[model samples]
Target chain A: MLCGAGRDRDVLTQQLQRLGIVPVVVDAMSEPVAQEPCDLVFIDVDVGRHSPALGGGVDIPQDRPVLALIGSDVPSAVEWVIEQGACGYLVKPIRGTGILASLVIACHVFEERTTSTRTISELRHRLKARQLVCSAAIRIIDVFGIGEDEAFHVLKIGSMERRTTVEDLAAMIVSGELSVQALGSDVEARRLRV
Target chain B: MKSVVPIGILFSTQGPYGTVSRAMRDGAMLALEEVNADDRFDFRLEPHVQDPEGVPAAYLSCAQRLLREEGIKHVVGCYTSSSRKEIIPSFEKHDALLWYPSHYEGFETNDNVIYTGAAPNHHVLPLMDYVLRHVGRDIYCVGSNYVWAWENHRIVRELTQVSGGRILGERYLQVHDCDVDRIIDEILDRRPSFVLNMLIGESSYAFYRAFAEARRSHEALHDTVIGSCTLCEPELAEIGASACGGHLSSSVYFSTVETRVNQAFRDAYRRRFGERAVPCADAEASYNTVHLLARALTGTTPSEIEAVKRSLYGVAFAAPQGQVSVDSENNHSFLVPRLGVSRSDGTFDIVRESAEPVRPDPYLVWVDGTGVWASWNGRRRELTNRPRLRVIR
Candidate 1:
């Protein structure tokens, strides 16, 4: 937890200890402790804005969930916390009542966010791979003088023969690393071998 | 001279959900009269009643007119969450306070509104706990398609999942839609241990009647009971004699509670609105709201919204439901939760009740640790355990 040395930290640490979570309190001005293998990070938004390290462009690890300790509801203070990618927050004068709730919400929200982010990135990669496959198929259609389905079939055959993914073979074809004529030959060779 | 304060009363009283709203309005009116009659306070409340007729848009207009034109600062009304949400901005803009008096799916804390209703922790959580402990966990949910149903069902779904139970089926109908034969057929087909009914007003009454008819024919459905958090006395009467009994409802206030305070309340309500207008949870909350408002505005002007709100916080009233008080942090009431079984007389027989008023957790942040959050995190572990394999071979 990145917080200024004060009563808030003391209360938060005590409460966290009661919940069976060990509190590793870090000063706000210190560098982002990316080496620390922590499940969650609690950053004080009030102290975060004034920190030379956080304000001077330190990247808080996006993989771990961040929970903001918010005392003020002002837009700037809250917006800064949002920019830090806080998944949940606890209102200041850090009491024990809401700590478990905040932790639960933070973990739930963070898991959701991480899942969606992973899905989006996976979708983006698939889309790019799909475009490559399409481009490779189109190139095969032009070079081998075949229909779209037949061209895709030829690519599939070549991928199977080469023991590579269809996407990988498509990337190779699209990048002009392997000629469509060579892939057609490979397909013919495989069919003859079979 | 007693200072007169104009307070706005906004309720539908003539729409799909009119039965409950009428009772709520009467409850507020009764409290207003009591406040006016009581010599203990220095101020007398004059109620300016407006029936929004259950339309969401009308609530905004009615609330605007009350706050802007009539210059009323405090309004005791809104039974549906949609109506409350609709007019909240108007209250904020006009610097007025809305005393919402209905048990709702929580997760809101607007500065411009004082929620006298049972928050999810005060109603749904307690009810869910009771049902899971005593009854079986396999539930089929049917509700009106809205936020209240959606949020409450979400809680039920999460809680059920955490407890290693399954939701057999879930369905939703439009707010006023009463075609429940298909849902009844589905319920009969699924044969869940219990049906969680989140349908409101007419839709709810129709479902109860239709389900009762289905149960008469199908022996399997006889044990498949219907449970709801929004069920009340007036609604049971609407469902009629054939279907009214044997249903379960969780509420903060049921007219059948055996207490001296409740006995007086029921007698006065019967005398004023007659036996037809049976007091329910919403009515009791509205009664509490008005009394709290009157106490808060004893010496201060209602126009000072901040002072009135400040005074309103932590205000306690010996309400019909028991000693109800406002939580200073959330502006929601610390209400006692009760689980009741409906009888043929259109009143609930109290099955279980909290020993004291439970503090309102509007966000469910405190009470929901073992519910959605736990289930979500549990799912996370399951996801991690499943081996992520690639088609390398």
Candidate 2:
């Protein structure tokens, strides 16, 4: 829990413990709210408001889920906490009844967002690799007077022989680090005969 | 030696919905009397009665006085959702528990309150199925302008929209405003399959009377019926004989629910409150509340709210309705839903009932398996193709 010293903080700690969640307490006002090695962070905006470090500057880290422990339901305070990027909130004075629900919601939302981000990144990587392979295949088709499918087959054989990915071999050929004729069995056999 | 604990009873027994609220208060009082007479508990509950007089502001003051001035930790009261919400913050502030006994629109769970009533999943969702299957695909809605009406209409709209049903017309009016003649006329003009009546108290009764008066000679009024989630024997009695019969109601408990437990409960209630006493869903809920409180206070000090809450966990009561239990997580009760038709004598004839008690799903996590969507084949269809109805004032 990245919260400062107060009754609200104590109650929150006790509530988290009741839920069998052991919180690593960090005074966010005195310390910075950053990548903490914890599953979730419970920030006390009421306490942290006193310290300019949290009140004025530090943004709540998005790496782990954040649950704001708010003392007031005033629209501005709520909006401020939401602006600080809170996934969920528990109205203070903190009660045991609300902690579990807020924690569950914040963690679930964070995990879902994280999973979607990873999936998007993986899809981008695959797209980039496909583009590189296609570029290398087109170059081979122009140089060897072979069909695009035949060029891809040659790249596949070369990749297998080199124990590298087809995309990596394609990159090597496109970069001029490896010759396309060297990948052709016909050229290889002729060179061997010579 | 029995340790005496003071509890609070807050209800508006003289409000627009006073007839039904009085029944609930009587039911709670009967349970208290029974518990006091019983030797099973080592503790006794002394109730401090506070009437809100059906005023919303009065509820706040009454609940505050009970929890703060009286120093009572447990309160068994609040008939309407508005009244319940009014007193909830005070209950939470005082760390007291409010026993709310009413069938209401769901989507709330508070630790400071124990809801010993029907959740939407147990009442309206199941009723939606019965209406769609037994009634027709087209419906007209009439309701008192309130949260209960608005929320129920939303749920019914969702249910009907998904199931190839159409709502012909919808209307709302202020509480106690019996200006339902125009709405009733609109209903007749549209001639929807049935009317979903969400109007409470006198307004509801007035609507029934007006509808009956307008459609008295029409033979089709028999099939073109009124369906409700709030209708009960007491309300039917208020509606009078001319317009009472042929209406369908969905509730957790009907005075007509056939069971040895229910028969005994009904007899005891009548004997205590006189032969005129008719138990309804809210009344049974209040009765369950007192008994559950007694059971929870078995060995623990009733002063400690946490201890009482802990003791209530997994506590099940063999209530008049059936086997009723509180879901410890949300403090809402598990209840069996029953469908009934109002008979000529202002009593219901239970036509359908659940085989077992259904767990409370206030957040609607459990999609009712008895709905139309469950029977539908996976084919996408536009909601526009179905007949459309306009909501009238």
Candidate 3:
């Protein structure tokens, strides 16, 4: 994570000396290339008003992931960098210390990219949960003259009040098993509020 | 790209409270284009935007329309927390994900969402500390009577009492359509040294307009200055130059920060949508979310919903706002805070900024922290983490 440094040279040099990690300051005007013998390089793309990938600035080793520092919500730039073979992106204005933490996660994404992944249970749970939440929302909409969003909130609030997950609460709501007292009270509170 | 996830985003438009919605939308759209460009999402993740015309109900209806009629499984935007709250249960019901990109009061937590904005510690608390140290002793808290302002003021009231500030008055009105005359009269009558505004929505422009018309603009408020957690660049675009200049507001990302990171963002925005499309912290967060999601979906095609959501955990991005992380525990981004003084040109100067980014504390689980989990003015209530979790009648 390249954060809080006014100049790319200063920030790069400090991280290089302090952590003994190689540094590559990115200029937005060129294309990105990973440098050698450097475990990591923090690209400073914003200084030159250019994308790190298009900038050709970073020169980290081939095997290592090019950790590109991009804006937090610049999805277009993020996508652009990925298209140029950036392994990871660290949103700018990162906490000074958060740089270390960002490196940890970047390494994780890098490992997952090259390793075995996916589990059947994760898929099963996600599908079941989606069904339950959606069905419960439909039931709430059917029960009350409200939109799907409201129904979803009813289920969410019900789940929270009942101290359970939305899937669990949705299950109960669809089963006609969860008490209607909470939902009734919530509706009453809102009616009084508006 | 083989998998296409249709994402629906809900936000406001240029009605009154500045063009934050438009500016934010522009920023988000840029991100959407980037996210859908990946080879994995060949379906071209189409974005369905709802103006909601700044109505609370409209936000609910928009969420409903998107989820039911359009089958959108992901929601990425909402300007107001209340509007977001209104659709929380909807997202939950559909088992979809809502990545809220705004700062908010913290009193609740939920698992189906990610808050990319500042929670209490990063946003409200720091400003409170600043107001006490630099501003004054007496206070008038004003806001739209929605969840964000209502709960945000509650936290202010508590912290003010603890910090030796006198809470002279507190008032509320319906967002965007509130009767500002009455509220203005009350504030003038109270004559508090500083007005703490926690207002949002369409009427956000109206309140500032009233304050300026009453000659209570941030400039005129000398010993009686007005400070707000809201009222940033977007509000300025609505209020024009006079109502905005020197207005003290708090946020994480202000467009005027003098840094290489911000300069690049500003240049691109100017090149793409004109310099007027300067970014706030939330916009950066929204932009980063798309890139992070894209990086996560790089190797594998998310043929399954669970795969998409779970993969989002550790994806990192170098975004304009700052380097952000998806809290492995709670999934909210840890962002830094900045105090911006609005200029006449719909931009802000970084008057004050957090020494560093505060860790994402969406759950508010820090020791001696405040949340629904903590004592609020010596009371206990079950708080839920519903970002923009709205209550509907």
lDDT of each: 0.79, 0.78, 0.62
Pairs clashing within candidate 1: none
Q: Candidate 1's error at B378, in angstroms?
A: 31
- Candidate 1 chain B, run of 10 with poorest lDDT: B384-393
Model 3's CAPRI class?
incorrect
Clashes of each: 0, 0, 65
**Tens digit of lDDT per residue, candidate 2, span B70-115?**
9999999988876786578788888889988888887778899898
Candidate 3: tens digits of C-alpha lDDT, residues B263-375: 87778667777745667665666676666666655554434446665777766665665666677566677676667666777777565655445676543456232232122
Q: What is the TM-score of candidate 3? A: 0.58
Q: Which residue ranges in model 1 land beyond 4 Å of their true spot?
A: A1-194, B275-277, B369-393
- Regions of candidate 3 where Cα sits further than 4 Å from its true position: A1-194, B1-3, B14-18, B36-44, B216-221, B300-303, B363-393
lDDT of 1 at B163: 84
Ranking of all predicted structures according to DockQ, beginning with the best and ending with the worst? 1, 2, 3
Instruction: Report the backbone clash tally of model 2.
Output: 0
Cα lDDT, model 2, residue B20: 88
The number of the candidate with the highest TM-score is: 1
lDDT of 1 by residue, A83-157 (tens): 889999997657678899999999999999999999999888878799899999998878767678777788888
Of candidates 3 and 1, the better by DockQ: 1
Query: What RMSD, rounded to one decimal, does every model reach?
Result: 19.0, 12.5, 27.9
Question: In model 2, how well does chain A match by TM-score?
Answer: 0.68
Per-residue error (Å), model 3, residue A111: 62
- Model 2 vs. true fold: TM: 0.65
